[model samples]
Target: MYSLTNNQLYSMPKAVRIFASSALSLGLTASLIFYPSASQAGKNDTGVPAELQGEWRYGRISSIQYQDSYTGQSAAPNGSSDQFQLASNGNYKRNRLLQINTYNCASNLFIEEKGKVKIEAQRLTFQPSDSTSKGQICNSGRTYSSRNTAKPETYQWSIETNEYGQQVLVLETADGKGKAHYGRPQ
Candidate 1:
């Protein structure tokens, strides 16, 4: 058994120290060169998750209209334009459904029309509550009404990336169906 003295135990040869330092420095350089950090991976050019579960600010409302060929009547096609303000804090709200802090609306009228909304991967679905038809009149001179008549409609939404890497959500739905164009507030 060869026992080293106290001084020798704590001391390393000059050559060994130099070799270790060089190896460490080389490893660090290699890591930085080959494996860039997440922040350095092109300016964090990412987009909102497929699931729109966070808060979104209200943007615009574009009414979609169409002609009912059968009745030759101009009908207010089922469609709506809305915005969303998403927060990293995991809180989310839809402009067409509820008025959030970032939304500017006199009343929650849109909510009454669209009802509750939920976003799934690349799709948004909502249903208008029966209460929305409170004073709505039908063509028969009777009050328009519904008992859970509002059914859930789904829309396929996508995120578009431009040259600047900014993102925009493109929403499309069937004609005479739910609203169109849902995106972040301008």
Candidate 2:
């Protein structure tokens, strides 16, 4: 019932038209990315494994905590907490809080990401839901990969019990450049 005439669209300001077009494209893309297609919606729901369903947390952890990464080395030294929550419906979320402790002050920086994930043959694959910028700052737009920027990060995961007898979520990057250990939250 609703339609836009070519003349009317052409009459709008160029910037307005571009913005509207971009907005519509982004909305369509988001919907397609986040929703399952008709043929795959409900026939079989292959969710993540049971032991990996709850919340897994890291940081505030000692250098000697869980097995570092797949290589068994400790992760980089940083003041941050990483939490991962894998739901029953294959939906997953990860929240990272970085604390910058200066000589006399402290600031908190946080980033959140969500997507659908599933386990197959003992391996967990994350389909990241990040679709935008990594920072909210006005000028620099410094990446969120550090203490001051908003960075979008990703990882592959697994369930493991550390030497300390605690359940841990082992996460590593696809290239093996990054690794982390998140213990079962107490």
Candidate 3:
């Protein structure tokens, strides 16, 4: 077996480097690393694994706390929820909603997308057939809507056990800047 130094490993392409680092850290072989059946679930004919087929939802709330002149300390809250339906044959639909409330004003956005998906080397790629987006601000009475066809989007995907001891699907953007955790509806 050959060994790679940090310098050599860091010189690889981003995806390769990520794969290599994960494989090395987990002591997994290349073949075992990307095979869903080895760790999570079995794959179907289209390479969309069984674990990924079904309804999954993600929700998160974020708050910013700051000192206020009159209130001493206050928090501004925002949150988002996303739902995905993945079919056995590599078809998918997604609905996402986001809301922000602060200073007696509220803003909301809703997005829907449908597409075909494929899994390769732990990466999930979505080829969107259609998409729609709408947004509104309550206080300003401003609203907007748009419909567009999106290009293919890809993300690294994995299955993990969440704090509740349930299997969750995790997807991260290629740059690792955006991540979402999806779980089966309770």
Top lDDT hit: 3
RMSD of 2: 16.7
Which 10 residues in a row give candidate 3 its minimum summed lDDT? 26-35
lDDT of 3 by residue, 1-186 (tens): 112345545644454445334433312111111223234348788888888899998776654433456666553566667788999999999887666655555666676889899789689887778988666664477675667533567788888765555777777767665666677998
Model 1 residue runs over 4 Å out of place are 1-51, 56-124, 127-131, 134-147, 162-166, 174-179
| Candidate of highest TM-score | 3
Candidate 1 worst ten-residue window by lDDT: 26-35
Residues 63-134, candidate 1, lDDT per residue (tens digit)? 434556566665443322344444333233333331111111111123223345544445545443432322
lDDT of 2 by residue, 1-186 (tens): 001234433544454344323322211100111121122222235655666677887665223233334566533332556677888888877775543322322233455667777565545665656522122221233233322222333456655555565556666655554456666777
lDDT at 95, model 1: 31
Q: How many backbone clashes does candidate 2 have?
A: 3
lDDT of each: 0.34, 0.47, 0.65
Better of 1 and 3 by TM-score: 3
